[model samples]
Each structure stands twice: as structure tokens, then as C-alpha cells.
Target: MILKIFSNNYIINITKSLPRGVYRILPSEEFKKDDIVVFEIPEETKKYLFDRKYVPSIVTSMMKKVASEKIDDVIEINNNNELIINSKNWGKVYKYDSYGRKLPEIDVKKMKVQKGEIFLLSDYSDRSFDGRYFGVVPISSIKYKVELFFRF
Candidate 1:
């Protein structure tokens, strides 16, 4: 499924915000928070949602900075190899395996932002399939940030 957009990269000067409608991906790397981005909707979400292959979303949360190796809080590594985050924030700590690796089940808070993931939200949440259900999206997946919308 391909997202259609103008092939030429150009910017238009306009004042009023365009009405809510379908937008094509105008791939760029200068997107900021709250910007509406277009990405290939994950296959998992497509099973029960929109029929389109690509979708638009608003960036609700953006990673401030890349995480470094620092222990801000302790976190437990569950049996599934998934990090269980009980609190809102995930601290900076590195996870590794030692000789005869033992999966530590410790209580801690905070989890670092891995892969610089961004949280997305749908413009029309009530009827839209978006980040609320898709979870955080990596910056690499964002194809474009919508600047204008059009309807036919």
C-alpha cells in the first residue's frame, strides 16, 4: 500500500488551517511535536480498522533526547523478555545478560525511551485508527508531516 503525495518538494504559503481530510505523505525530516505525520499503518492494526494502507496521525509525545547508560530507576524484566513499566516514566538503565543469565525481577521506576519512539494520536479518534491503539512509533516510520489537506 503506497501513500500518494506530490512528488515535487515544495512549500506553500497559507494562513487558515485546512479542513480535516485525506493527506498524502510529503516526506521530510523536520517534523516537530504535534505535527500530523503519515506512516504505513501497522499490519496488526489493519486487521480491525481503516481499509487504507497508510494513515495520518498527530505526534502527541516526542523524545527530548537520546538516552545514555545511566541508572535512574530499577525495572523488572519479565519472563516474556518484556519490560514491565508500572509508572509513567521509564528510567535510564541498561539490561544485559551475564554468565548463566538470571532474569532479575526487581522493583524499579522509570524507563528510558528506546529507539526515540514518538507517541501518536488520531485526528479523529472516535472513528480513526491511530497511535492510541498502535502504541509508540519510531521516527524512522514517519514518511511525512501533513501541512495541507484536500478533499475530492
Candidate 2:
């Protein structure tokens, strides 16, 4: 099994099956109701039709397009404490105090993002299965940014 680290979390292979699916991992507290997450299909399994590379992207794009109207503003703070605002609609903005802070328990109504934390975007407006379904995904699950792929 190949292991990947996203942020400070770890994504590992487990033999047991989960309610949502077959794979499972420890998630971060920051994972909320509808955060977008990427799952990489193992190289050995790529031959299957379900392993298509564009599947996830197409889903993400469609989700973004449908939720365009509900998208909220994203506020980014630069190193100099300058706040940069992007007009594009996003799920939500979360602030973390430091790089390795654990995600807090879900309390969407009362929870506020802390400084230095990451801001996550949910995939849809409806109660679709996502971060909320599985819980916050640990940063370790991320293997690396999807750069390029070569199929054998």
C-alpha cells in the first residue's frame, strides 16, 4: 500500500471496510459537512474503468458550477497581515492558528476558524456524502498535489 501525507495527516491502507466504502483513514477536525477531498486509485487498480483520472475533476467542476450562486467569499491574509479578498464563491473560510493544529469538533453554527489554519471548500449545497459523511480527513491522506500522470 502507498502512503501519502496531506498537511499533517496520514492516509494509510486498512484491511477493513467502512460504511461509506471499503477504504478508511483518520481525518482532521477541520473536515466539515461538505469539504472536497481527493482519493487516488492505486496504480495496480488503474486498469479498471472506474479508475479514470477525469472522474474526480468532472465531479468537482460540476459541483462548483451548480453551487456557483451559493459560493461565499474567500478571505486570505498575507504574511504582512494584509487581507486579500477573492470574489469567486467558495464553501467557507477557516482559520488555523498554526500548521499542525488538529481540527476541532464539528459545530458549524458555533465554531469559528482560527488563525493560521486552512480554509476548505465543500463540494455541494445538498447533504451529499463528503467530509461530513466520513468526518475531517487527516492531512496525512494527501499523497501530493496531482501534477501529471503516465499510464502504462
On TM-score, the candidate that comes out on top is: 1
**What is the TM-score of each predicted model, taking all chains together?**
0.42, 0.23
**What lDDT is obtained when candidate 2 is compared to the true structure?**
0.29
Q: Which stretches of candidate 2 lie over 4 Å from their true place?
A: 1-105, 113-127, 133-135, 147-152
Clashing pairs in 1: 74-108, 89-110, 90-110, 90-111, 90-112, 91-110, 91-111
Q: 80-123 in candidate 2: lDDT tens per residue?
A: 43223353333332332124433223433332334322233343
For every candidate, C-alpha RMSD to the true structure in Å: 13.3, 16.6
lDDT tens readout by residue for model 1, 22-123: 454456675554566555445555543333322234222211111121233223445544333333222222233223332222232233334555544432
Worst 10 residues of 1 by lDDT: 60-69
Model 2 earns a TM-score of: 0.23
